[model samples]
Target: MQKIRYWVVGGEYTSTDFETLIEGTERVVGPFESRSDAERTWRYLSEDHRPQAQVRFTIAQEPQGTMTA
Candidate 1:
């Protein structure tokens, strides 16, 4: 079975979603299985890396071997 992957990131943006490389942020946990897993990790990490006023956590998903953005 093909495994889907989720990635977490943080940044400020006017309009964008599922971007591989967001302008102000880098991939935090890279790709893992499931959005829930990624969100859990993001929540834990956000404690130390709190997002600023314009920044927010984001999760992007992709199926293995398929382009997501």
Candidate 2:
């Protein structure tokens, strides 16, 4: 299975404000199985918790095939 990394952005509302917003909330980020899953998670968090915040999902894949020796 391929490993994926998920990053949660737009949490620049200051430590105090962010803490207040995230209180009683579970993790807003995750490692999903696909790009669509990652996007969905970002959308859910942005809409329900941070409507004014800009959210984005990025996926990085290693190039296939052998490299020149």
Candidate 3:
């Protein structure tokens, strides 16, 4: 069985359009156990970078398991 996990990903984008993230600014914040925990982290990061118009963060989910071919 596979377990679902969450992560917070994103960073300063190249522009306000948010199409591309700056090379060194890329960030991936963790494998949280729950969505709420990820949301808490997302909120903190978003607020911390609030002054930067191009900074953004979002939660991403993935299945924790190996794939069989």
Candidate 4:
């Protein structure tokens, strides 16, 4: 099984990085069954931009079994 998770990467690496893991910024969208469905959700959520806010959406695949960070 797989789920579609959405994460936003913003700001400069020097000042701030995605690793900050801000709850408001980094979001988890859905558990789509198909890859295409997941991609679509990623695209739709990322369509809007703040112009100054350097942000992008990413897709992460969940591990099949137990895994560690």
**TM-score top scorer:** 3
Model 4, 13-40: lDDT tens digits are: 2223534544455556655666677788
Instruction: Supply every candidate's count of residue pairs whose N, Cα or C atoms clash at under 3 angstroms.
Output: 0, 0, 0, 0
Give candidate 2 regions above 4 Å deviation: 1-3, 9-12, 15-28, 51-69
Which scores greater on TM-score, model 2 or model 3? 3
Displacement of residue 36 (Cα, Å) in model 1 is 2.1
On the 0 to 100 scale, the lDDT of residue 31 in model 3 is 84
Candidate 3 structure lDDT:
0.90
Q: Candidate 1 local accuracy as lDDT?
A: 0.66
Question: lDDT for each of the candidates?
Answer: 0.66, 0.47, 0.90, 0.53
The residue-by-residue lDDT of candidate 3 on 4-69, one tens digit each, is 789999999999999999999999988887899999999999999999999999999975564343
- Each prediction's TM-score against the native? 0.55, 0.40, 0.87, 0.55
Tell me the spans in candidate 1 whose CA falls farther than 4 Å from its real position.
12-24, 63-69
Between prediction 1 and prediction 2, which has the larger lDDT? 1
Q: Which number leads on lDDT? A: 3
Candidate 2, 1-69: lDDT as tens digits: 335454444443424334433333334465455667777767776667554452222333333342233
Could you tell me which residue pairs clash in candidate 4? none
